[model samples]
Structure formats: structure tokens, C-alpha cells
Target: MLPKKVKKRASLLAITLLVTVIGIFFILKSLNKNILYFKSPTDIKNNQNINFDKKIRVGGMVKKDSLIIKEEEIKFIITDFNNEINISFSGTVPNLFSEEKGVVAEGKLQDKTFFIADRILAKHDENYMPPELKDIMKKNAK
Candidate 1:
């Protein structure tokens, strides 16, 4: 038979191990909930079995001349060169948000082509211009 002290130590160790596992499990589960996967319009177009119910982030450049402002909602198209996804946002957009700017919208996909945005994240830099815009300007300069 194991000594009394050894038995107590083993039981304590087992309890500690179990508690550690449970803690890790809860930590990972919570992290999973907080993780928002980013997808482009092309990715959505290629994935036919996407879960529309889950919240996700869609990143792309705003399509030119696509912004439609209304009293209740703002609508626009996000494009990834090959595909475009329409988005409807019912909140105030950032001041830097405009056509041809990079944007990432967090929302639930209503359908393959439509996204209802809960948040709009416009790409901004200290210089007030992203590299993409610089390239456009360079091209226009040529």
C-alpha cells in the first residue's frame, strides 16, 4: 500500500492536473469566441458553404461610386479585384472611410452577396495615405 503522505500528494497532484486542464479548456473556448476570421470578397464567392450566421470580418477596398447614403443606413460594395460584396451598415462610418479605401467590416453575412455590418474599420495611417493610394498616384503620374 502507498504511504499516507504519498497518497495525499498523488490526490493533490491529480486535482491540480484536472484543474489545469479545465482552466485551459475554458481559456481556449473563450479565445475561440473572441477570434474573428477575416475573409475577402473573393473568398466568400468561392466558399459555397460559408456559415452566414457566424460573425466575421470582410476586408477589401470599397468599390468606387458604390456608396449610397440614406437617412437610416449606408450601403456600399467591397471588392477584391475579382469579386464584390454588398454591405449595409446602419451606423456612423469613420471619417476616413470613402470609395477606393481599404475597409474591414465586422458583420454577419445575410447571403452570398450581402453583408450586414455591425462595425466598419477603415484603414488609416499617420501619413493619411495607404500604400495602395500611393501606387495609384504613381500610376497616374506616369
Candidate 2:
């Protein structure tokens, strides 16, 4: 038989562990809903099923000479060299956003080829390139 103090301590420890676990579970649940997956243009092209209603982030280098800035819209093509996805964004352009630069567009796909971006994120520095994007560029360079 366990002593009274020991039993009380055990119950307190169990409650602490349960509370911690419940806290973690809720945190993960919240994150799962808000998580945005990053995909390259090649990944998008190869996948046949994509949810148009869900927002996703697409990362790639902007295709050279493919940017067109109109009065109301900005259109560009992002390419991993193997495939390309056209992006249409209506928002303030980031200073780092330019042709031949790394950019990530967050939006829903109107179709497989066309993406309507609600937000555009550009690299903060010149040396910043996503590891996946770097690998894709290196594989295509050879």
C-alpha cells in the first residue's frame, strides 16, 4: 500500500501530465488548420489533385521577362525550370520582387496553371533561397 503523501503526489503528477498533453493537443490542432505547405512549380504540375479552395504557398524563381505590371494587376510566371505556374497578384509589390528572383506566392489556384495570389512574399536578402528551391535549381543546372 502507498502512503497518503505519495498517492497525493502521484495524482498531482498525473494531472500535470494530462494538462500538458491537452495543451499540446490543442496547439497542434490549431496549427494544422493554419499550416501552409510550400510547393514548387514542378510539384504542382505533377500533382493531379489540388484543392482550389485551400490557400497554399508556391515558391520558385520568377521567370525572366515574364513579369507584367498593369495598373490594376501584376502578372508573373514562377518556374522551377521543369514547370511553370502563372501568378496574378493585386497588392503592394515587395522591393525584392523582380524577374529571376526567388518569390513565394500565397493564394488559391484558379486552375493548375493560374494562381490568384492574395499575398506575395519575397526573399529578405539576396542570398536567401529556400533549400527546396536551391536543390531544384541545382538539379536542373546539371
Candidate 3:
């Protein structure tokens, strides 16, 4: 026969474990709302029904000859080889932003595959040479 104290301690331990597990579950559920996902234009094109309320990052190359600036609003098309998505933003663009460059826009998609960007991030390659140009230079050097 087990002692009374031992049985009480075992029960208390079990309850504590259950409470800890439930606390962890709620913590993880809340944290999930803070996590944003990144996708490409092709991914967005394939999954057109994604929830628009949530924030996300979209990465792609700025399509050539697609940039249009009108007063405060700037519009461009981002392409991921397989698909292109039009983006519009009314804010100061990054200094490095230009046509045919790789960019990641943080925003949400609106109607008709239009991305309303809240922020635009443009990346520059090291050595002052763009990645595409660097690749060409490397091939020629070899």
C-alpha cells in the first residue's frame, strides 16, 4: 500500500504538469500571430486565396520597364520568373530601388494581385556590382 503523502504529492505533480502544458499551448498560439511569412510572386499567384489581413514579405525581381511614378505614389511590377505581381506604394522609396533589381516588399495583397506595400527593401550586391552583372563578369573571367 502507498503512503498517503506520496499519493498526494503524485496528484499535485500531475496537476502541475497539466497546467504547464496548457500554458505552453496558449503561449505558442499567441506567438503564431506575430510570425510573418515570406513568399514570391509565383507563390502568391499559385495561392491567390491567402489571407490578406496578415502581413507578409514578397521577394522578386522588379520587372523591367514597369516602374511608374506619379506624385507621391510609385508603382512597379515584381516578377519571380514564373509570375509577376503589381505593387503600389505611396512613400519614400529606398535609394537603391530601380528597375530589374531584386527587392523584397513588406505588405499585403489587395484585389487583382496588387500588393500594397508598407515598406520596400532594396538590396545591393557587394563590390558595387549587381548580382546579375557579377555573374556575367565571373563567367567571362573563367
Error of 1 at 26 (Å): 24
Each model's lDDT: 0.90, 0.90, 0.85
Per-candidate TM vs. native? 0.63, 0.62, 0.61
Q: How many residue pairs clash in each candidate?
A: 0, 0, 0
**Best TM-score goes to which candidate?**
1
Candidate 2 global lDDT: 0.90
Clashing pairs in 3: none
- Per-residue lDDT of 95-116 in model 3, one digit per residue for the tens? 8899988888998888547899
In candidate 2 the C-alpha lDDT for residue 140 amounts to 100
The digit string of per-residue lDDT tens for model 2 on 74-109 reads: 999999889999999998978889999889999999
> What is candidate 2's CA lDDT for residue 41?
85
**TM-score for model 1?**
0.63
User: By how many angstroms RMSD does model 1 differ from the true structure?
Assistant: 7.2
Q: Report the error of model 2 at residue 54, Å.
A: 0.6
The segments of candidate 2 whose C-alpha lies over 4 angstroms from its true place after superposition are: 1-37, 124-142
Q: Is candidate 1 or candidate 3 better by TM-score?
A: 1
